[model samples]
Target: MFSTVENYWIKGTPKEQLMDCLTAYKKENLLTLAENQLMPMKKSHTKSKIATALAEQLRHNFKITVDQLTETERHILTAYASGNLPEELTEPQQAAQATLVAIGYVYLFKENQQITPIVPKELAEQLLENESEKDTDNWFLTTKTTVETIYGRCELSHLVTAWNQHASQPITMSEAAKFV
Candidate 1:
């Protein structure tokens, strides 16, 4: 997750500049600096919280270009901000959505075994205001399938393979009976 944001950060500035920005932010907030670098103390901190704070500070204070998100990611974020994504998603869409969740742009909630996306209030507001000039409806929608079925199929396949691999190694009835 940090890798994704780090890539974006490095693209826009030198490593030293990034570290300096984090250091200044940490000092301004009275937060301890991370070991060997300039990140704030991360104990008990969520990645989304850290990323959002860092990104906001970098953009607002340093005028750093931090949002290097792909067009697909941007659209997914937009839909998430507008609360317009379909309730269910296809495997590929889910994977992409998972990336968004991982990168701190969105969040997920599980209720009654169903997972849903929840966009952060501040992020949604910023995106809406910043992207207002663009035509968001041009974003494409794709078909979706539930994650449970995908996991089920994957587990079934692995079980079948394991069973086939060990099928020839028979255990004696006495050994089986010992466990029983």
Candidate 2:
């Protein structure tokens, strides 16, 4: 999932690798989401195609078996590419999810060409649009500057750190901020 990948990236994985893994992961998630959507309608056969496409992409890009991926990785990819969130991700997962959401990586028909704000859609569209560009060949491309920008926002890091701090408790953003 983008959240897990973002968590790893936020913790300091290189952007290129984050983008690489996240891009692959996003596509894979789309396939699974599509499978879920269609399965109950008796169109489950399409999942095979989705899997094949994922395999090829994995082979060409990540250089690993699809089996090596975690459940969050798989689910987030599906949810993101499909422009939705799964009901499952827990609180810590939500912290990563919020980070990704804040960075404007959560919406798509294609990658957004803007660097998101602390609250993502809260900023003026033109301002956000003026700040970045989507790298079409790789939908997940993000810069170190962007990561640094994210870090500069204590509110964001505090939010994640709060989640990290209370990995066991059910805390909302407002409560987490106060505690942090």
TM-scores for candidates 1 onward, in order: 0.42, 0.21
| Candidate 1 minimal-lDDT segment of 10 residues | 136-145
> Which lDDT tens digits does candidate 2 get at residues 44-146?
4344455444334433432132234355643454344333645566875666455434233332222343221121131223223322222211211232235
lDDT of each: 0.45, 0.37
Model 1 scores a C-alpha lDDT of 0.45
Relative to the true structure, candidate 1 reaches a TM of: 0.42
**Runs in model 2 lying further than 4 Å from the true structure:** 1-59, 63-65, 86-89, 95-180
Candidate 2 lDDT trough over 10 residues, lowest sum: 132-141
RMSD of each: 19.4, 19.5
Query: What digit string (tens of lDDT, one per residue) describes model 1 on residues 15-36?
Result: 2222233332323132322221
Which residue pairs collide in model 1, if any? 89-144, 89-145, 90-144, 90-145
Deviation (Å) of 78 in candidate 2: 1.1
